[model samples]
Target: MEALKEVYSRSFFEQFVKVVKREYPPFDKNRFFELIYDQAWPDRELKMRIRHVADVLTQTLPPTYEEALGILMRIAPGCRGFEYLFLADFVELNGLSYYENSIKALEMFTVCASAEFAVRPFILKDPDRMMAQMLAWSTHQNEHLRRLASEGCRPRLPWGVSLQMFKADPGPILPILDNLKQDSSEYVRKSVANNLNDISKDHPELVLDISKRWYGHHPHTDWIVRHACRSLLKQGNPDALGLFGLGNAEGIDVRQLVTSTPQLKVGEDLIFSFHIQNLSNDARKLRIEYEIGFVKKNGSLSSKRFKLSEKMYPPGTSSVSKKHSFKPITTRVYYAGQHKLSVIINGREAALVPFDLMDGNP
Candidate 1:
């Protein structure tokens, strides 16, 4: 697979230069190319390349911030995609001092490509003013702008700078979320859910309160509440589980829990099977999950939970079988050692089983 940074290749820049030249005839395409392909270009990563492009634009575009932004706006609609995020990055890198113009530019550019990453610096510079603007954007006619209202203020927006102030006290963000809780677009609603999810990491109680109030009000709101409380649910928060009627495992049983292999190897699958019974007479909601105590570098265990099933179980037994692969992936390293797996029903651990992992054959 090609590195994402390769999207800013010479081919992309050729098209980019043509559009910019069409809008602003004086655009220094020669100088732009020269600077863009400088000594440090090849080594720069995706974000670094974006910032580099934004920096190059600073030199090739008009000297004044507003003038450069105007040219960008004219060419923005012609440019689109994740690759074109640099359009917004230009405003973030150069237009911080020009608040009114930068804010307007971000709004316009977001229509072509999201300004989610661009708007955070303004939020940091003037929380009160930027948040007021975000509140106004919450009701914007453009769904992109409405989505930006929630996405831009995310405390821990991935690949974007974290907003410490909002993470510390997300009071201002709540009003924006409230206004957008029932937005018409799923794109906008997903951002609202993500914003709430980010908030939940720091202020679980606050999110729980909001989830409780919004759960049954509207279908959209219900979806948002459930998604927003995912982290809390994963942690077995009683309040979070109760919202979905997934209560404690009072009348559940785990039987015949065993693994296919006495010992396993990396890049192999660990096949396991078990039986679950609802011992009670009445139907009960059961969230069946598995926990893996992965062996760490220092011989300690890092526990991770994965959901298997979540539904109502009647007074009977059901056989279950599943397999988990230990494929080599960039994100996690598999350590060769003794490991354990367990069944968790409704947030309660039911059965314990141990397995050994050996290094895969080279």
Candidate 2:
């Protein structure tokens, strides 16, 4: 597979220059290419390289923003792949002064690549005005634009600036989510769900209320509610669990819970086993999961839950065993200490076990 950095390669610049030259006859394709491929040009990272190309466009394109924007409008329709790189660059370059125009440009640019990160600065600068525009975009005929409308304003948008105001109080974004809740495109709906999920991190009750209010309205809306409540479900919040019919396991019995190793090094695996039996006479729905309480630097424990299985449990016994590797991963830092593990059935903790972690270093 080609590396992502290759997206801004010489060929990409050549294709982009070709498209620009078609609309702007005086576009100095050679000089533009030379500037982008200059010996000093840092092609080491994708984002930095994309910014370098944008800088070249600023130097080579028409001096005035409108003239350059007009040329971009023509060039944009023909641009493909990571062409949104240029559009996003344009937004970041001129968004403050040409906020309205940048919003319009992003509507076109997002269909090619996401403008979610591009629009965030404008939201942070003038949230009221920018979010008002986004609310209007929620009903846009273009699914990409509608998705951008919600995705851009996400409180915790990855790779984008955090919308802190929304994090403190997400009331302002609720209307935008409401407009797109029943959106025709799953793309738009998914963004709405993610936006809500971000809010759930800061304001759980607000998300739960929205989930309750929006439940059963439409099948698509139901999906949004479920996805929005994911974090709450992972934490085994009772309301969130009840909403998904994964409440307490009334007639369930957990037995034979054991760990393969009571102590292991960071690179080793921690295996476990368990058995569950349904005490109820009739069939019962169950959502089985496991939680691992990782020891943090402060001697406190932070738990992460993983889904094990979910199905109907007839009046019989079932056995399950699994292995979880504790290999070093970038996302988590393993500290040498005692950790806790628990079995969760229908959002109820049925068993708990402790294990010791050791650093491989001598």
Candidate 3:
């Protein structure tokens, strides 16, 4: 697979230069290239490279911010996808002082590539005005702009800077979420759910209130509410579980929980099996999940949960077997040490088992 950073290759810049030169005749292609591919260029990661390109544009484009934004607005529609988000980042890097022009540029740029990250700084700069603009954007005719309305203001947006004020008091964000709850675009709706999910981490009751009110109103809204409460459900919050008809695990039993081996090596699979029986006289809903307590470098454990199944279990025994690979992935670093695996049924732990993880080829 091509590294994500490769999107800004020489070909991309060659094409981008052509696009900008058409909008602004004075665009200095040679200088832009010279400055962007500097000594530190290769060492820069994805976001650092994006900012480097933005900085280079500041030097190569028209002298003033407005002139540069004018060029950007004309060239933006031609630029599409997450790779072109440097256009929006350029706005965040240089357009804050331009205020109205910056907002206008963000509105235009988002049509092609999202201004989600760009808009957050503006929200922090002037909460009332920027949030009002965001509210207006919630009902935008374009799906990307509508999605930006929810995505930009997310309290804990991944990769984007955290909106600490919103995390503390997400009241300003609620109106925008409400407006986009029934959005026609699934992309926009997902952002609304994610925004609510971010808020749920800090203010669970507020999200629960919104969930209870919106869950049954519309199918789209229901989907948003269910997804928004995902974190709460994983944490075994009774209210969140109850909203989905997943109640106490009083009658659900884990007959046996066993791993293929107590000690396993990296790049190997930890096969496990268990039996579940329902003691309840009637059929009951169960949300089954597995928890892994991974050892950290400091010898502390960080618990991560993976959902296994959720279905109606009758008053009988059902067998389940699963294999968890210890394969290394970019998102998580695996440490070899004592680990714990637990079976969770209906938000309650039914069994806990220990295992040992060894280094490669052990």
By descending lDDT, how would the candidates be arranged?
1, 3, 2
Candidate 1: which pairs clash? none
lDDT of 1: 0.91
lDDT-wise, the better of 2 and 3 is 3
Per residue, candidate 3 scores C-alpha lDDT tens digits across 185-257 of: 9999899999999999999999999999998989999999999999999999999999999989997899889
Each candidate structure's TM-score, on Cα atoms with residue i matched to residue i, is 0.94, 0.85, 0.97
Each prediction's Cα lDDT score? 0.91, 0.84, 0.91
Alpha carbon deviation, residue 273, candidate 3 (Å): 1.1
- Cα deviation at 40, candidate 3, in Å, is 1.3
> In model 2, where do residues sit more than 4 Å from their true spots?
1-3, 25-49, 259-271, 294-302, 325-330, 333-340, 354-362
Error of 1 at 85 (Å): 0.9
Error of 3 at 243 (Å): 0.8
- The 10-residue segment of model 2 with minimum total lDDT is 40-49
**Any idea what lDDT model 3 has?**
0.91
**Cα RMSD (Å) per model?**
1.8, 3.3, 1.2
Least well predicted 10-residue stretch by lDDT in candidate 3: 21-30
**Candidate 3: residue 362 Cα off by (Å):** 6.1
lDDT of 1 by residue, 1-362 (tens): 68778998789899989998888998888899999999999999999998898999988898988888888988888887888888899999988899988888899888887899999999999989999999999999999999999999999999999999888999999999999998889999899999999999999999999999998989988888888988888888999999999988877899999999759899999999999988998988888899999999999999999999998878889899999999887679999999999998878899989999999977
